[model samples]
Target: MDTPNRLAAAVSPYLLAHARDPVDWHEWGDEAFAAARRRDVPILLSVGYSACHWCHVMARESFSDPATAELINRSFVAVKVDREERPDLDRIYLDAVTALTGRAGWPLTAFLTPSGEPFFGGTYFPREARHGLPAFTAVLAAVSEAWRGRRSEVAAAGAALARRLASPPPTADADPGPDALGAVYRALERDFDPVHGGFGEAPKFPPAAALEFLLRITDASDAPRAAPMVQATLAAMADGGIHDQIGGGFSRYAVDRRWLVPHFEKMLYDNALLGRLYTRAAQVTGDPGVAGVARTTLDYLVDDLGLPDGGFAASEDADSEGEEGRFYVFTWAEFLAASGDAASLAAPVLGAAPEGNFEGRIVLHRARPAEAVARDAGTDSAEVEEAVVAALEGLRALRANRVRPERDDKAVAAWNGLAIRALAESATVLGEPRYLEAAVRAARFALAELRRPDGRLLRSRRAGRGDVPAFCEDYGAVALGLFALFRADGDPAWFDQAGGLVEDMIDLFGDGTDGGFFATGRDAPSLIARPLNLSDHPTPSDNALAAEALLTLAAYTGEARYGERAAAVFRVAGRLFEGAPTAVAHLAGILAVALAPARELAVVGPAGHPTTAALLAVAEESFRPDLFVAWGDGHCDGGIPLLQGRVALEGRPTAYLCRGHTCTGPTMDAAELRRLLTRRFRLSDGERRVGP
Candidate 1:
C-alpha cells in the first residue's frame, strides 16, 4: 500500500520492478554521483538489464529487504544502471569488474570510489548467508569497514586496476588464417553433447553466431562436416523446449543439457538471428522441416511482437506474475483442458505428466523427430504435419488467454536494423511480400522517429520519445537495414537514405588519426577511454557492419567511394587480424566482394513489368549480399560505373548485369539472367591475401 521508491519514478521497466525495494536506489546519472560525493561515501554500482533473471533475484532477495536497504542507504551511495540504455558506461565498468574478479555477469555489484574508480565487484548476493557465500548484510559491512579503515590501500588497488584496463595486453597479428574455422570446429567437437546437440554440459545457449560462422565456412569451402554441424544444431534447437512448440519462436536458452527446460525469455535478436540461420540451413540442406521452424519464428514476431509502427519490440521477460516459466509451462491436466485428444498425441513426445519439470507441469520438448512421430501415429509424414499444425493452433489460442510475458516496447535502432535484415532476407527466401512490407515499415519508423533535425540519428525510442545521440551501432545498423530495403523493394530512396547516413557516420564516428569508426560519437560524452570493439556480440559491431553496408551500397550505386571507405576500415583493423578474425566477419563479407567479381544489376521498366519482376525476384532470391539491384526509368546518377547509362532494354522489362564498368547484353528472360548469375567470379592467386 506504501508508495514505491525512486526506481518506481524511473522510466525503465527494469528499474521500476525494483522500485519498492527498501534499499535506497538511484538511477545512474549525475544525482547519484553528487549524492555519493556529498556523503563522501563509496558507491555501490549495480549494472544490469531488465531481461536478466539473476538481476531480478538479487533485487528481490537482498535489495528489497528493509534491513538490507538500511545498511546500503546508511553506508554507501547505491546507483543502478540499465546497461541497455548506457552501453558505454556498462563497457567501462564491466571491463574493470572483469579485470578485478576475472569474471562478470548480470546483477553486477561493484564497489566504486566517488570518482567512479572500481575497487571490487561480484554477482548476486543472498539476503542471508547461504551456499557458502557471505550474506548481503555481512558483505556490505565488511566492504564499508574496509573502505573507511584502509582507504589508501583500496585507492592504490583501484588505481592499479584502472591502469591495467587503460592499456589492454598488446595483441599480435596471429593470422589463425582459415585454420581458425578448423579450430572452432575442433573446439565444438570436444565440447558438443552427443545426445543434446549443442556445445557445453548444461545451461545451453543457442550460440547463433557460432552456427552462422560454421554455415559461412561450410558454404564457402564445400565442407561436409560443416553441414552436419549446422543440421544437428538446428534440429536439436527446433525440437527442444527452448523452442515454443505450440507457439512460434524460441526462448532465451535451455537451462539443462537435454534442452528439456528453458529460461523462458524470448529476445528479438535471438529469433531474428536464428530465423535467418535456420532459413539458410533449410536452403542448404533442402529440408522443409528446418524452413518450417524459420517460418514459424517469423510468424511469432509478426503475430505477437510486431509494433504497429513497424519496428519489433526489444524482448519478452522471463518472468510472469512473479514466477519464472509459469506462463509457458503446463501440467498434464492443463494440457488436456486446453486440447482434448490433441494432447494425447503430444503427451509422449513432450514428456508431459501429472507432475511437471519445474512444478506440477510440463515444459514442452520434442524428444523424438517428426518422422518418429509419424511412425508412432501410423500415418504419412504429410498427415503428421497437418495434425501437429492443428494441435499447435489449438494450444496457441489457449496459451494466449493465460498470462503473457512483459514486452519491452522500446524499439532500439540497432536491434530493429538486425530484424530488418532478417525480414528482408526471409522475404526473398520465402517469397513473402508481407515480410518485405514489415522490413520497410520498420525502416520508415526508424527514419521518422529516430532522426534529429540536423540529420543525426538517435540510438533508441520508447513511448514516442527519442533520446541519446546515435552510437556507431545505431548508424551502422540503420544504414544496413536501409540497404536491405533498397535491395528488397528497389526503392531509390532507401539507397539515398543509406548513403546519407554513411556519410554522416564517417564524419561523426570515424577515427581521424586512424580509419575505423569508434564506438561512441565525437560529440558524445567522454569516457575514460574510447572503446573500438569489433567483436561480435548479440549483434555485430558498428565498425564491422558499417564496412558491409558501405560495400553493398557501393556495389548497388556504383560509387567507388563506398568500397574505398570499406577497405580503409579493414586496413585500420588489419593489424589485429590474427588476434580477432571472427570479430571481423562483416569485413570478411566486404573482402569477399573485393576479391571476387563485382556485379551490379539494374532492371528498368514500369513497376509492374513482368520481366523486371522476374529479374528482381532473381536478385532477391540469391544469397549474394555482394550484388546490388535498382529498378527505375533511369540509372543512378552516382551509381556504380558498371550500371551507369544503362536503361530498360527495348522499353520492356529487361535486366543488365555489369562488372567493372562493362555492361553485358540485356535480357528479359529469367533463364538468361540465371545463366549470367551462375558464372562464378574467381580470384587471381596473387590477389588472394588477408588484411594487414
Candidate 2:
C-alpha cells in the first residue's frame, strides 16, 4: 500500500494527485518555509496547476519515482503549489525563473531561500539528462551543493532578486491618450497573420481580450481591417480542431498556426472569456453562426464544468489514460463506425481520412462547408446541416462511453466570477434565461460558501470546503460578475454587493503609495515579495480587473475616487503599455473605457413593462464597454446614483442618457433610445477630463 504524505490534507487537486508520492512534499505556506529554515535547506518550489500537461508529465516522471523522490526529500524542502489557487507565488516565481532562463512555463522549478526569495529556477527538468536539459536529480544536486558550499553566491542571487522585486515600476513619460490605442492597434496589425487569421505564428491562444478590443474599436479608419481580423479569427477558430468539434468548447490552445491541433485541456476561464467574446461577436456581426457558437460554448460550461453546488470547476485535464488528447481524438474508422446514418455525409465535412491527422487518430475539424458537401452529395444545404447536427449528436454519445479526462473539481472564485460574467452577459444577448439563472446561482454560491463572516472572500472551494484567502483578482472578478448580473436582471442587490466587493478590494489589495493592487490580500500570508500581475497572460491581470471593476462602479455611483484609483492602476501599468501593448490587451480595453465618454443609461419604468424591456434591449444591442445600465421603477432602491433621480416620464416607461454627468431628455421611444446611445457627442468643457 502506498503511504499518504502531508499533501493528503491539501485542498488542491494537483496536490492531492501527488499525495501518494514518496517525496516529502509540503503545501505552500508557513509550515513549508518554517521546515526549510529549521532544516537549514533550500526550498524546492514546484509550481503548476491541475490542467497543465507538462506538470502532469513532470509529476509522473519524477515525483512518482521513489529514487527521485528520495533525492528530493534529502536535498531540499519540496513545496507544491497550485498556481490557480495561489497566483501570487506563481507570478513571483515565474518572473524569477523567466529572469533566470529568459523563458518559463509549468511545471515551474525554483530554488527559494527559507524566507521565500527565489534564486535559481528553470522549468521541467527531465528525470534523465536528455534534450539539452540536465537531469532533475543532477539539478537538485547542483542546487544543494551551491546552497551548502557556495552559500554566499546563493545569498547574493536571492538578495538581488529581492531588490528587483521591491523596486517600483517605471512610469510613462506622459499619461496615455487615444493615440495609445492607435499605436497598439498598429502593432497588432503588424503581428497579425493575414492568411490564417489571429496574431503571430503557431500555437495560438484565444486572444479573448485582444479580440474584444478589436470589436470595441469604432474608428471609421480602423474598422475595415479590425472587423475582418475579428471575424476571420472567430470563424477560423470555430472551424478548427481546437474548438472541440465533437464537444462545444475550446481547448487550452492550438499546437499549429491554423488551429488544426490543440493541447486538449479545457479551462473554465478560457471558455468564460470566449463565450462572452463570441456573444459580443454575434452582436457586432449579426452572424447566426457566431451566435450558435456562443450558445454552445456557454452551454458547455453549465453542462460539463458546472459543479453540484452551483459553482463551476477550474478545468478538465488534457490527458486521459496516460495519453494526451486520447479522450478527444478518434480514428477515422472509429468516426465512420460511430457516425451512423450520416457517416458518408459527415465524413466529408469532418475532415476524416483513412490516414489520420494526428498520430493515427483524427482531431476533428470542419474541413468542408455544409453547402459544398450538400452540392457534392446532391442534397439541400438544410439537409446537410441537419445531418451534421445528427452526426454530432451521435459522436457525442459515442465519446461519452470512452474513459473521460479527470476534472479538477476545484471551484476557484476568480474563475467562477469570469464564468458568471459571461453567463449573465450572454443570457441578455442570447435571450437565454437559463444562463442568467446559472450566473445568479454561481454568484449566490460564492457569497454564501466562499465568503467569510468578516465579509472577505475565499480564493476557492473544493469539496464544499474553502480556507484560502481571496486575492485581488478574486475580488475584482467577482465584483465584475455581480455587476453584470445586476445589468442583466436589474437586481440592485447584485449591484450593491458588487460595490461592497470593490470597497473590500480597495481596502485589502490597494498599494496606497505605489497605486494599483497586489495579487495577494493585505492580511494574507506574506511571501518574499507582494506579487503584482502587470500583463493579461492567462486572464486579465489583477490590476486591470480591479481598474475595470472600479471604473464601472464609478460610472454608476458617481464616485470620483473609484475612477482615481483606476487611473492610478493605469499609471502603474504605463510601462507595460509602452513596451508590450499586446501583453496589456485587457488594460488597453479598460484604457479605452477611461478615454471614451462616460455613458450612464437609466430606465425608469414599471417592472415587466414592454416599453421598459424595449429600452433595455436598445442598450444591450451593441457592445459599449463605457456604458452602464441602471433600471428601476422610480427610485434607486439599491443606492445606485444613476437611477436616483430617474422616473417614468408622463407615467410611461422612459429612458435617460447621460455622458459625463450631462443628461439628455427622457424618451419613451426605443428607436430614440437607440439613436441616443449611438449618437456621438463631445463632453462639456467643464466635464472634459484627461486620459488615465
Candidate 3:
C-alpha cells in the first residue's frame, strides 16, 4: 500500500481521498510554493471538490498510477486544493485557464511559477492520448521541459498572466434602471428553450438567479416572456430525471436539454435555491402541485443532508460502489421486483422501459402528467397519482438498502446559510412549523460552531473543527439567513446577530474606495489577485449578496450609510449587469429592489393572537419584494426602527404602512390591512403569471 501523503491530516474530504495516491500530494498553501522554489520546479495545482466525478476519474487514471506519479513528483510540486474550501484560488486560476483556453471546468489543472502565478492550464487531461487531447504525462513532460529549456519565456508568460489577473474588472458608475431589467428579459427570451423549457442548448444548469429575477418582475406587461419562461422551466424540472423521483432533491445539472439525464451529484446550494424558488412559485401560482414539490425538496435537505451538528452537508457524490449513478438507477428486473404489481401501472407514467433509458437501467422521470396518464389508463387522475406515489415509495425503500453515495460531510457556512433562509421562508409560506424549527436549529448551529471569539464567521466546519477564516460570501449569506429567521420567528437575538454580521462583513471585506466587497477578507491569506465576485454563479456573488443584506438592514434601521454602501456596490456591478444581465441576474434583482419604491409595513400584536395571525397572513399572501415587514408584539423591544412606536389600535392587532417619511394606517381590521397591502403591492387577481 502507498503511504499517506501530507493530506492525511487535512480537514477537507477531497484532500483526504487523495492521501493514498502514488503521487506525493501537498495541501495548498505557502509550504507547497516554498518547496517548489527550493526544488526549482513549477507548481502543479490541482483544484477540485470532493463531489466532482471527473476529479475522481483523473485521480484514478493518473494520480494513482506509480509511473505517472513518479513523473509528476520528479518534475513539479503537486498541490491539491478543495475548490469549495478555497474558492478564491479556484476563481483566480479558473479565470486564468479560461483566458488561456476558451473554457474551464472541474479537475482544474494549472501549472504555476514557484511564486504562485498561473502560467498554463486546462481541465481534466486524459491519462493517455485520446479524443484529440494530449496525454496527461505528455502535458506534464512538456510543461517540465518548458520550465527547464524555455525558462525566460515561461517566466515572462507567468508574469504577464499575473498582471492580467491582478487587474480589476470593468466598472460603470451609472445606476441600472428599468431598462436593465427589460434588456435582461429580452436576452433570456432569445435563449429560452421553448420546447424543453431551459435556456440555451444541451448540458443545462438550473437558472436559480434568473428565475428569481423573473419572479420579481412587477409589471407583467413590460416583460411578458418572464412568466411563461419561469413556469415552463420549473414544471419541466419538477418532472425531469434531474429531479430525483424517489429521492426528493435535484442533481447538479442535466446532461441533455430535456433535463432527462443528470450529472447525479446533489449539491446543498442547488436544492436550497431551487426549493426556495419553487416555494415562491407556489405562492405566485397558488398551485398545490408546486407547493408539494417545494415541501419535498425542503424535506430532502433535512432528511438527507442535515448533519448531526444541525448544519447541512456540502454535497452527495455522483459515484457510489465505484460507478456513477449506481445508487440511483435500477434495471428493469430490479424495478419490477421492487415495485411489485404497481410496476405495470407505474412504469408507463415513470418513463421506464424494458430496455432502460440510461445505461440499461431506469432513471425515473415523469413521462406524462397524472391527468394525461389517467386518460390513457381509463382511470381517475387521483387514482393514477395514488398508484404512482405508492410505487415510488416502494422504489425509495428498495434503494435505501443499496450502497449509498459518499457524502462530503463538510458544512460550509455559505451553503448552510442558503439552507437556513430557504427553510425559514418556506416554513412561513408553506405553513410548516417543522421547517421553521429546522431553520432555527441550523442558524443556531452556524452561530455556535462557525464563529470566532470576535464574532467573525468561519468558511466551514467539519467534524467540529473550523479552521478557515470566513470569506465575504460566508458573512453575507449567513447574515441574510439570520435576518430571515428573525422575520420568521420575531427573534431579537437573530436580528442582533444578523446586524453584527453585516457590520463585520463591511469592515472585513468592504473595499471602501472600490465601492464593493472583495471575495476574500482583509485577514485572509494573500492570493495572486483579490477578485470581486459580482455576478451569480452556482451561488450569488459575495458583493451582490452583501449589498442585498446591507440594503435590507438599511431599510429596517433607517440608516443612510448602509444604503450608501449598497449603492456603491451597485455602481461597481453596473457594467456587468448591463453587459451580461443574465450572468448577473441576482445583482439585477437586487438593483430592482433598490430602485423600487420603498414601503415599510409594521404589524403590532401579541405573537399568537388570532387578529395578529390574520394581519400577518394578509401581508404574506402576495409577493412583496419591495416591501419590508417588521412584526412584533405590542410590548416587544429590539431597537428596530421600523418597529418603534408601533402599537395595536383599540386593544386589537394593528398594522402600519409607511412610504418614505409618509405614514398611514394603525388599522385593527385585517380586511383594511389587506386592502392597503393590495393597493401598495398591486396584488393580482387573475391567473398568477409571474412577478412577485
Point to the candidate with the largest TM-score.
Answer: 3
Ranking the candidates on lDDT from highest down gives 2, 3, 1
Estimate, for each residue in 379-410, the C-alpha lDDT of model 1 and write its tens digit.
66665556555666666777888888788777
In order of appearance, the predictions have TM-scores of: 0.91, 0.97, 0.97
- Per-residue lDDT tens digits for candidate 2, residues 1-692, read 18899999999898999899999999987888889999999999999988889999998899999899988999899999999988888888898889889999899999998988888999999989999999999999999999999888888889899878766677676667666676667777888888778899988998998888788774434445778889999999999999988779999999889988999999999999999999999999899999999999999999999999999999999999999999988887778777878888887788888898989898889989989999999998898888777878877888999899999999999999999999999999999999999999999999998888888899998987779899999999999999999999998999989999999999999999878898888897666778878789789999889999999998998879999999888888887776888888888878877887789998888779999999999999888777899898875556888888777888899988997666798899999989888775443443223221
User: Which portions of model 3 show Cα errors greater than 4 Å?
Assistant: 681-692
Q: What value of lDDT does candidate 2 attain over all alpha carbons?
A: 0.88
TM-score of 1: 0.91
Per-model C-alpha lDDT, please? 0.74, 0.88, 0.87
What TM-score does structure 3 among the candidates reach? 0.97
> Which scores better on lDDT, 1 or 3?
3
Candidate 1 residue-wise lDDT at 17:
73
Whichever of 1 and 3 has more TM-score, that candidate is: 3
Give per-residue lDDT, candidate 2, residue 373: 97
Error of 1 at 468 (Å): 1.8
